[model samples]
Target: MKPVSILFVCMGNICRSPLAEGIFTHITETAQQQHRFHVDSAGTGGWHAGNPPDPRSMEIAARHGIDISGQRARQVNTDDFERFDLILCMDEDNLARLSQSCPPDLQHKLHLFSQYAHGTTQSVPDPYYGGADGFLTVYNMLFTGCKSMLEKMGADDVAS
Candidate 1:
């Protein structure tokens, strides 16, 4: 089967989106299903593009035994719609923005990040304005969402 590709999007790639990328990548790799999927992240805005994920984000990932240090901030490219099988937005506003920017052929690929998350419609709050605790909360939320995503990708149901 062809690999499923996913792109996580947020307002800024520094915090939430990178966390989702790292967490989901870690889960897929650990499950030995890394070949089944491709994961990446981007921001709706160009702010922080080309910068490494925020220090708090890296530190939190480290604490959880995942490495996010390699992730750099990037803007959601027009090509991303063609590249990713799913373009998941971190919240409603960004979802709308992605919807507006995406071409007609790719519009079906855009989705809310929380749709993969079990029983939660909450946005992964932008932690850039808050303290370390906020990063931790974002981490936990992404962890849950990533896990759910992995399960749906056949990691949980597929036998090795």
Candidate 2:
């Protein structure tokens, strides 16, 4: 079977989304199920395109043993709607931006990254201007959200 393809999106791609991609990749790799998934990230806008994730994001990910240093920022494209099995945006604004451009037939694949989080907040806040602590908080949220997303996809069997 083809591996499930997931794309994480945010406004700048240098913060939240890249962190989510790294965290999700780490979880799958740790579970020895990396082969079952393909993960990537992008932003709703191209302002940060070609840049690596924000330094703060890389720092927090490093603390968790995940490196996001190699990931570069890109903007969401029409192709992404068809390329990924699931497209998860970090906040409602990003989701709304996607909703506007996504083809109707592919709308089903678009979702809030927090939908599977099982947390009180349904959106992942941007931490670009904040301190290290904000990155840490976003990391924890993505950790929980990624795990829950896998479970919902019935990929929890491999999450062990």
What's the number of clashes in each of the models?
Answer: 0, 0
lDDT at 152, model 1: 71
How well does each candidate superpose onto the true structure, as a TM-score?
0.93, 0.94
Q: Once model 1 is optimally superposed onto the true structure by TM-score, how far is the C-alpha of residue 6 displaced, in angstroms? A: 0.3
> Which residue window of length 10 is worst by lDDT in model 2?
151-160
- Output the TM-score of candidate 2: 0.94
> Relative to the unseen true structure, what is the Cα RMSD of model 2?
1.7
Tell me the deviation in Å of residue 13 in model 2: 0.5
Model 1 pairs in collision:
none
Q: Give per-residue CA lDDT, model 2, range 1-160, as digits (tens).
A: 8999999999999999999999989888877778889999999999999999998999899988999999999999999999999998899999999999999999999888887457444789898888888888898899988888776666655443
